[model samples]
Target: REVELRLEQANHARQEAAAALGAVMERRRMLEDRLRVVRGELQSTVVRPVDPAHVMRLQVIEDQSVQALKVVRTHLGTLRDRQRALRREAGDAGARLATARTRLEELRNAAEIARQEISAVAVEIAELRVRGESVAEGLRRDADASVEEALEVPRPDVDEDLESLLASHEAELRRLGPVNPLAAQEYRDLQERYDFLAAQLDDLSSSRAELRKVIAALDERIVEEFTAAFQEVARYFEEYFGVLFPGGKGRLRLVDGSDPLTSGVEVEAMPLGKKVSRLSLLSGGERSLAALAFLFSVFRARPGPFYVLDEVEAALDDANLRRFLRLVDRFRERAQLLIVTHQQQTMEVADILYGVTLERGGSSQVLSRRIRERSQPA
Candidate 1:
């Protein structure tokens, strides 16, 4: 009975130790997994505190602890792989960051240089403007003084000298009047001849005065007509430019010469939102369009019987050519348009097409054809 009781107690003790060992093995496994996770997080820049107390708290049988240590060793392998990948990424990012920082410094230096250059240019421009104003003022003062001097100079009196000579001749003739009988007859004949000559001269003077008045009236009429026509042409120019540039605008002013007899008209073309003067400052196509607009405006105002346009669309593009054709169609009511162009669009709008062909013999011949179909004679 005593031996059986001792055997039963030893069996219970062995079973309890085995159960405790199993529990300790499970805890050791959990700690190994936690260590692997922490090591991985640390490689990825995640901070983790080491728990020596938790590792010491793990109570396992000797063999179980040995097996848990083997599991922890496997974590080192994965941790090494993670560390390698993280190091490569960090190295590439550092290189990129260094390049970006260098570029930022260079841009800052360039911006500072540009700012200094702009400040210097602004100072120079201000000084030049002031000097230019002073020079212009000095020139104007000199011009004024020269004009005053010219006005104060004396001039010869041609009309007064002629009147004095004529009066002296009349006095001499009167003094020799009614002397002797034969002398008086001769004197009377001479006086009659002189009176006839004087009457003829007076008629000539009156005729000259009338001619001068007629010329003055004609000049005034011509000036009025040209001024009105010029204004109308300017209005057409404005409309045409507005159509071409859409939202943009332009102005056409007629500049007159200083001398009336030698005076001529000049076109002052000013584009909207531009500071430059003259059409020459524009691009090639723009200059062509501006010239075309001016010519069209003149034609609209004057309205010739027929126009002779010679290759005027050479510089125009497809879009601009369309606009030009539209303008021509609008003007067709006022005048007949005869456009010469090699473009298909211009050929399409022709009423009577004339083709100039060079034959094999090198001679050019004009071939005229009516574009519209004609009905056959019945």
Candidate 2:
């Protein structure tokens, strides 16, 4: 039945493959006809005059038709190969089905023979079980007689020599001590200590690994945050520095290259033509301006509630002094900027001011002043 079923499935598959092959062949024929027509059209001259553009268009159409024909032929060849393979597979499957049917018939005949043999063996087993106790006693006597005959047989002389050698080996083993009375307790104590030490070592190793992992995670977080802040600050620093010195450039970089977590940063600035490598290299006014730029850069990157600057623009010239006031004005829009400057430009931009003055007694007094604005005409 299984062989028949396989044969039926094989036939169905062959029919399906044949149908598909016919469809593929029909499609291939149609494509070939279309391609032939296109090539004939390309070779034929039109009644109108031929120009370069017309020739080019015909060339393109011919090329496309040739490509399409090659694709169709390639698919046709693939289908032919597939059809051949399917025919071969169907033939092989038929042969296998025939062989399997023969094998099944043989197995069925063998099963019939085995059934008869099993029935006979079952009857024989039942008859043997029904035999009386006398038969059992007779079987026991026969077994005893066989055992006695086996015992009566003499063994070879080499066996005694082997037995003596075995005795000598036993004597040699006995010469080594049977037990170590005191050593046992010492061994127990040593084993206990070893187990305790091993367990403690394992626990310590795991704890150390966990600690290292935690340290690595923390270090990674710190580096990520620091790098992000550094980039933002560097960008703002360049902007502020450019505004402070219109034609110059400034850069902020880490002093240490390899490790950002344990590194210091330095600023390099060039004002129009002067290259200032260090903060100390600048004049007092330039130094003040650079410091203020750096501070505002940090503030722009990470804004705060308020800021307090005490005469920070005191050393700047009128030009840089105006630039400084611009930065102050911009920052005041985003934060509460408190300036204690003696510069008139700083005072001019101030929305409100709290003036601090010293009394003769050496104590400082704080006073608040709201600058009144001029009213607009309606």
Candidate 3:
């Protein structure tokens, strides 16, 4: 819902930019015509050679015309720039609108699916309640015979015992308020539902046992998989760390050596000639490089289709930025990297660069450049 609201706002801003761009274009056209008219007037005035006495007057008029044309041209240039900016703003807003719409549709479909499932369960509940009431009504009408009379043996002694027990509690029964006309039916329906629930609970208990067995198996598999992956990632981490920081010695360790599955992981790096044992003790640039190495290590262990980063190298200096990009380049061989950053070194190394800028009126515009095309940044 919030996303929808934001989409509405973005659309509104886009429309406003469109309108503003049209106005600016119209104003620029008018200014251009005015400049042409001013030029024509100056031309007509100086078409013939002026006499000595009137030359000063003609010159004065020409100077004023030239100044007016300069002012008009300046205004036209400003309007044209404004129009370009507004157009870009509208384009960016449209992109946001499209993305928001897609996300909204996905959310709506998910909610609808859940509603359908709940509605189906509710329908089943209603059907079961009705069938239970029907059975209860039939029993109430044939009070002399039990539903189990055919299956169960006759027992007058047990019946007499139950009658005696009922007689003993008859005073308490009489102390109760008036009975409901549909109490028996309601009770029967509740009992039916309870029985259904009990059966469901038994099924659930069976499922739970199966799930526990599955979980135990999964735990064993996870330990095997995690241990293998951790070893690979740690190997990569150390190798990349050394390359990133020439003489650095970095190691990844599980807090509990015996239980890698549930243990916490620690990364310690001794950079170059430093005696630091923990990552936190390293300088900002050192830490950034260390983190980048660790990230690349995980990617090497289990690569994905693409990796996304936001200002990941913000703390790195130029030298470390180069190292970070180098690692990114190596990882890029296996996975596409999408990075959001303002660092020049990061931008320069990008195969395709995407950027967002604020136009004159404080509206955002999105643009992209491809390294393959040798496109220059503006």
Candidate 2, 11-78: lDDT as tens digits: 45445544554554555456556545644543332212212233234234434544554554454555
Q: Candidate 3 vs. truth: CA RMSD?
A: 32.9
Point out the higher-scoring one by lDDT: 2 or 3. Answer: 2
Error of 3 at 164 (Å): 38
Best by lDDT: 2
TM-score of 1: 0.44
Query: After best superposition, candidate 1 residue 135: deviation in angstroms?
Result: 99
Instruction: Provide the TM-score for each candidate, comma-separated.
Output: 0.44, 0.48, 0.42
lDDT of 1: 0.52
lDDT of each prediction vs. the true structure? 0.52, 0.58, 0.58
lDDT of 2: 0.58
All candidates: CA RMSD in angstroms? 59.9, 32.7, 32.9
Task: Give the clashing pairs for model 3.
Answer: none
Q: Look at candidate 2 and tell me the lDDT of residue 336.
A: 70
Candidate 1, which ten residues in sequence have the lowest lDDT sum? 46-55
lDDT per residue, candidate 3, 143-229, as tens digits? Answer: 654556522434336446545544544544454434454634544453453344334334433533443454345446545755676
